[model samples]
Target: METDAPGEPGPTAERDATIEIDVLVVPDCPNRQLAEERLRQALDETGLRAARLTTRTVTDGTTAARTGFTGSPTILINGRDPFAEPGAVPSLTCRMYRTQDGLDGAPAAARIREALRAAAAAGGGA
Candidate 1:
Protein backbone atom coordinates (compact mmCIF):
# COMPACT_ATOMS: atom_id res chain seq x y z
CA MET A 1 0.00 0.00 0.00
CA GLU A 2 1.05 3.56 -0.60
CA THR A 3 0.32 6.67 1.40
CA ASP A 4 0.62 10.39 0.86
CA ALA A 5 2.28 12.21 3.72
CA PRO A 6 0.66 15.41 4.98
CA GLY A 7 1.70 18.52 3.02
CA GLU A 8 3.73 16.39 0.65
CA PRO A 9 3.23 16.05 -3.08
CA GLY A 10 1.60 12.83 -4.25
CA PRO A 11 2.01 10.78 -7.42
CA THR A 12 1.10 13.64 -9.74
CA ALA A 13 3.80 15.77 -8.16
CA GLU A 14 6.00 15.10 -11.15
CA ARG A 15 3.67 17.10 -13.36
CA ASP A 16 4.45 20.20 -11.36
CA ALA A 17 7.81 20.39 -13.05
CA THR A 18 6.04 21.41 -16.26
CA ILE A 19 3.47 23.69 -14.69
CA GLU A 20 2.81 26.82 -16.74
CA ILE A 21 1.84 29.95 -14.88
CA ASP A 22 0.51 32.98 -16.71
CA VAL A 23 -0.41 36.38 -15.43
CA LEU A 24 -2.67 38.28 -17.82
CA VAL A 25 -3.29 41.99 -17.49
CA VAL A 26 -4.25 45.04 -19.42
CA PRO A 27 -1.70 47.71 -20.38
CA ASP A 28 -2.20 49.73 -17.21
CA CYS A 29 -3.69 47.24 -14.81
CA PRO A 30 -3.44 48.60 -11.30
CA ASN A 31 -3.17 45.22 -9.62
CA ARG A 32 -0.60 43.69 -11.92
CA GLN A 33 2.22 44.01 -9.43
CA LEU A 34 0.10 42.76 -6.57
CA ALA A 35 -1.00 39.74 -8.52
CA GLU A 36 2.53 38.91 -9.59
CA GLU A 37 3.89 39.22 -6.08
CA ARG A 38 1.19 37.02 -4.59
CA LEU A 39 1.67 34.42 -7.30
CA ARG A 40 5.41 34.30 -6.67
CA GLN A 41 4.86 33.78 -2.95
CA ALA A 42 2.32 31.05 -3.62
CA LEU A 43 4.68 29.29 -5.99
CA ASP A 44 7.38 29.33 -3.35
CA GLU A 45 5.03 27.99 -0.71
CA THR A 46 3.84 25.20 -3.00
CA GLY A 47 7.41 24.13 -3.78
CA LEU A 48 6.97 25.17 -7.40
CA ARG A 49 9.76 27.70 -7.47
CA ALA A 50 10.87 26.54 -10.89
CA ALA A 51 7.47 26.64 -12.56
CA ARG A 52 7.42 28.54 -15.84
CA LEU A 53 5.93 31.99 -15.38
CA THR A 54 4.70 34.28 -18.14
CA THR A 55 3.03 37.65 -18.35
CA ARG A 56 0.62 38.49 -21.15
CA THR A 57 -0.79 41.85 -22.07
CA VAL A 58 -4.39 41.83 -23.20
CA THR A 59 -4.68 45.12 -25.08
CA ASP A 60 -8.12 44.79 -26.57
CA GLY A 61 -11.47 43.09 -26.10
CA THR A 62 -10.72 40.79 -28.96
CA THR A 63 -7.55 39.62 -27.34
CA ALA A 64 -9.28 39.11 -24.03
CA ALA A 65 -12.03 37.04 -25.57
CA ARG A 66 -9.68 35.05 -27.69
CA THR A 67 -7.46 34.20 -24.77
CA GLY A 68 -10.33 33.57 -22.35
CA PHE A 69 -9.09 36.35 -20.16
CA THR A 70 -11.73 37.21 -17.59
CA GLY A 71 -10.06 40.48 -16.70
CA SER A 72 -6.83 42.23 -15.98
CA PRO A 73 -4.54 40.54 -13.45
CA THR A 74 -6.01 37.17 -14.29
CA ILE A 75 -3.82 34.28 -13.30
CA LEU A 76 -3.88 31.04 -15.22
CA ILE A 77 -2.36 27.79 -14.00
CA ASN A 78 -1.70 25.32 -16.76
CA GLY A 79 -3.95 27.42 -18.98
CA ARG A 80 -6.88 27.02 -16.58
CA ASP A 81 -8.51 29.71 -14.53
CA PRO A 82 -8.76 28.24 -11.07
CA PHE A 83 -10.64 31.20 -9.65
CA ALA A 84 -13.00 31.66 -12.52
CA GLU A 85 -16.67 31.58 -11.76
CA PRO A 86 -19.17 29.66 -13.81
CA GLY A 87 -20.20 31.54 -16.94
CA ALA A 88 -17.47 34.10 -16.53
CA VAL A 89 -17.15 36.36 -19.58
CA PRO A 90 -13.84 37.64 -20.83
CA SER A 91 -13.35 41.37 -20.48
CA LEU A 92 -10.71 44.08 -20.65
CA THR A 93 -11.12 45.42 -17.15
CA CYS A 94 -9.65 45.18 -13.74
CA ARG A 95 -10.55 42.04 -11.83
CA MET A 96 -11.55 41.72 -8.21
CA TYR A 97 -11.46 38.81 -5.81
CA ARG A 98 -13.39 38.03 -2.68
CA THR A 99 -11.13 37.85 0.31
CA GLN A 100 -11.60 37.31 4.04
CA ASP A 101 -11.78 41.02 4.68
CA GLY A 102 -13.60 42.07 1.55
CA LEU A 103 -13.23 42.55 -2.17
CA ASP A 104 -9.67 43.05 -3.31
CA GLY A 105 -7.88 43.69 -6.57
CA ALA A 106 -5.79 40.54 -6.32
CA PRO A 107 -6.51 37.10 -4.94
CA ALA A 108 -5.09 36.45 -1.52
CA ALA A 109 -1.83 34.57 -1.20
CA ALA A 110 -3.57 31.65 0.50
CA ARG A 111 -6.03 31.36 -2.36
CA ILE A 112 -3.26 31.31 -4.95
CA ARG A 113 -1.43 28.60 -3.02
CA GLU A 114 -4.58 26.53 -2.79
CA ALA A 115 -5.18 26.83 -6.51
CA LEU A 116 -1.60 25.79 -7.29
CA ARG A 117 -1.85 22.75 -5.05
CA ALA A 118 -5.12 21.73 -6.62
CA ALA A 119 -3.72 22.11 -10.11
CA ALA A 120 -0.66 20.07 -9.20
CA ALA A 121 -2.74 17.30 -7.66
CA ALA A 122 -4.87 17.10 -10.78
CA GLY A 123 -1.83 16.77 -13.03
CA GLY A 124 -2.89 19.91 -14.88
CA GLY A 125 0.62 20.81 -15.91
CA ALA A 126 0.52 18.48 -18.84
Candidate 2:
Protein backbone atom coordinates (compact mmCIF):
# COMPACT_ATOMS: atom_id res chain seq x y z
CA MET A 1 0.00 0.00 0.00
CA GLU A 2 1.39 3.33 -1.09
CA THR A 3 0.78 6.61 0.64
CA ASP A 4 -0.74 9.43 -1.22
CA ALA A 5 1.12 11.90 0.97
CA PRO A 6 3.39 12.17 3.96
CA GLY A 7 2.13 12.11 7.59
CA GLU A 8 -1.07 10.39 6.53
CA PRO A 9 -1.50 6.67 7.15
CA GLY A 10 0.01 5.04 4.09
CA PRO A 11 -2.61 3.65 1.77
CA THR A 12 -1.68 0.39 3.45
CA ALA A 13 -2.35 1.78 6.90
CA GLU A 14 -5.95 2.42 6.00
CA ARG A 15 -6.64 0.08 3.07
CA ASP A 16 -4.60 -2.74 4.55
CA ALA A 17 -5.59 -2.17 8.12
CA THR A 18 -9.08 -3.21 7.03
CA ILE A 19 -11.82 -2.59 4.44
CA GLU A 20 -12.33 -5.95 2.79
CA ILE A 21 -15.37 -5.88 0.55
CA ASP A 22 -17.23 -8.35 -1.63
CA VAL A 23 -20.27 -8.61 -3.78
CA LEU A 24 -22.58 -11.46 -2.88
CA VAL A 25 -24.68 -12.24 -5.88
CA VAL A 26 -26.90 -14.92 -7.39
CA PRO A 27 -26.08 -16.31 -10.82
CA ASP A 28 -29.56 -15.63 -12.07
CA CYS A 29 -29.18 -11.89 -11.86
CA PRO A 30 -27.31 -9.93 -14.48
CA ASN A 31 -26.95 -6.87 -12.31
CA ARG A 32 -23.86 -8.32 -10.68
CA GLN A 33 -21.72 -6.75 -13.37
CA LEU A 34 -23.06 -3.37 -12.50
CA ALA A 35 -22.27 -3.95 -8.89
CA GLU A 36 -18.73 -4.99 -9.69
CA GLU A 37 -18.18 -1.94 -11.80
CA ARG A 38 -19.49 0.23 -9.03
CA LEU A 39 -17.21 -1.46 -6.53
CA ARG A 40 -14.19 -0.96 -8.74
CA GLN A 41 -15.00 2.67 -9.13
CA ALA A 42 -15.38 3.02 -5.39
CA LEU A 43 -12.05 1.32 -4.77
CA ASP A 44 -10.33 3.67 -7.17
CA GLU A 45 -11.97 6.69 -5.66
CA THR A 46 -11.13 5.62 -2.13
CA GLY A 47 -7.59 4.33 -2.80
CA LEU A 48 -8.40 0.77 -1.74
CA ARG A 49 -6.67 -1.12 -4.50
CA ALA A 50 -5.22 -3.82 -2.25
CA ALA A 51 -8.53 -4.29 -0.46
CA ARG A 52 -9.04 -7.71 -2.14
CA LEU A 53 -12.50 -7.14 -3.50
CA THR A 54 -14.28 -10.24 -4.77
CA THR A 55 -17.64 -11.86 -5.36
CA ARG A 56 -19.68 -14.79 -4.04
CA THR A 57 -22.81 -16.37 -5.42
CA VAL A 58 -25.53 -17.20 -2.95
CA THR A 59 -26.85 -20.61 -3.92
CA ASP A 60 -29.03 -21.49 -0.95
CA GLY A 61 -31.20 -19.86 1.66
CA THR A 62 -29.18 -21.38 4.49
CA THR A 63 -25.96 -19.79 3.29
CA ALA A 64 -27.89 -16.68 2.56
CA ALA A 65 -29.19 -16.54 6.10
CA ARG A 66 -25.78 -17.15 7.54
CA THR A 67 -24.31 -14.46 5.35
CA GLY A 68 -27.37 -12.27 5.69
CA PHE A 69 -27.74 -12.85 2.01
CA THR A 70 -30.65 -10.78 0.88
CA GLY A 71 -30.25 -11.48 -2.85
CA SER A 72 -28.07 -10.99 -5.86
CA PRO A 73 -25.68 -8.03 -5.87
CA THR A 74 -25.43 -8.01 -2.07
CA ILE A 75 -22.42 -5.93 -1.16
CA LEU A 76 -20.68 -7.05 1.99
CA ILE A 77 -18.07 -4.84 3.59
CA ASN A 78 -15.82 -6.78 5.91
CA GLY A 79 -18.14 -9.79 5.92
CA ARG A 80 -20.97 -7.65 7.28
CA ASP A 81 -24.04 -6.83 5.26
CA PRO A 82 -23.88 -3.08 4.75
CA PHE A 83 -27.11 -3.27 2.82
CA ALA A 84 -29.00 -5.24 5.43
CA GLU A 85 -31.49 -3.19 7.34
CA PRO A 86 -33.63 -4.06 10.33
CA GLY A 87 -36.26 -6.10 8.44
CA ALA A 88 -34.20 -7.61 5.67
CA VAL A 89 -34.21 -11.41 5.57
CA PRO A 90 -31.68 -13.93 4.40
CA SER A 91 -33.63 -15.05 1.39
CA LEU A 92 -32.53 -16.48 -1.92
CA THR A 93 -34.81 -13.96 -3.55
CA CYS A 94 -33.50 -10.84 -5.23
CA ARG A 95 -32.64 -7.87 -3.03
CA MET A 96 -33.69 -4.30 -3.42
CA TYR A 97 -32.18 -1.03 -2.15
CA ARG A 98 -33.76 2.31 -1.48
CA THR A 99 -32.22 5.04 -3.60
CA GLN A 100 -32.87 8.72 -4.08
CA ASP A 101 -34.96 7.85 -7.12
CA GLY A 102 -36.82 4.72 -6.07
CA LEU A 103 -36.46 1.04 -5.18
CA ASP A 104 -34.03 -1.07 -7.13
CA GLY A 105 -32.42 -4.48 -7.00
CA ALA A 106 -28.97 -2.96 -6.58
CA PRO A 107 -27.64 0.06 -4.73
CA ALA A 108 -26.52 3.14 -6.56
CA ALA A 109 -22.82 3.27 -7.48
CA ALA A 110 -22.11 6.48 -5.59
CA ARG A 111 -23.91 5.19 -2.53
CA ILE A 112 -21.94 1.96 -2.47
CA ARG A 113 -18.70 3.83 -3.10
CA GLU A 114 -19.25 6.17 -0.18
CA ALA A 115 -20.00 3.26 2.09
CA LEU A 116 -16.80 1.57 1.01
CA ARG A 117 -14.77 4.68 1.77
CA ALA A 118 -16.37 5.01 5.19
CA ALA A 119 -15.68 1.39 5.96
CA ALA A 120 -12.07 1.83 4.95
CA ALA A 121 -11.71 4.91 7.08
CA ALA A 122 -13.17 3.01 10.02
CA GLY A 123 -10.73 0.11 9.53
CA GLY A 124 -13.53 -2.28 8.80
CA GLY A 125 -12.03 -5.57 7.73
CA ALA A 126 -13.17 -9.16 7.39
Candidate 2 per-residue lDDT, tens place, 4-113, comes to 67567665555655777778888767788777887888777766766778788888878888888877878888888776779877777677788899987678878877
- Per-residue lDDT for 1-126 in model 1, tens only? 223577787653456566899899999899999999999999878777767899999998887887789988899888888889788899988899989999999899999998887777677552
In model 2, which residue pairs have backbone atoms overlapping below 3 Å? Answer: 19-124
Reference-based lDDT, each prediction: 0.83, 0.76
Candidate 2 — what's its lDDT? 0.76
Candidate 2: where are CA atoms >4 Å away? 5-14
Q: lDDT (0-100) at residue 106 of candidate 2? A: 78
* TM-score for candidate 2, residues paired by index: 0.82
The residue-level lDDT of candidate 2 at 103 comes to 88
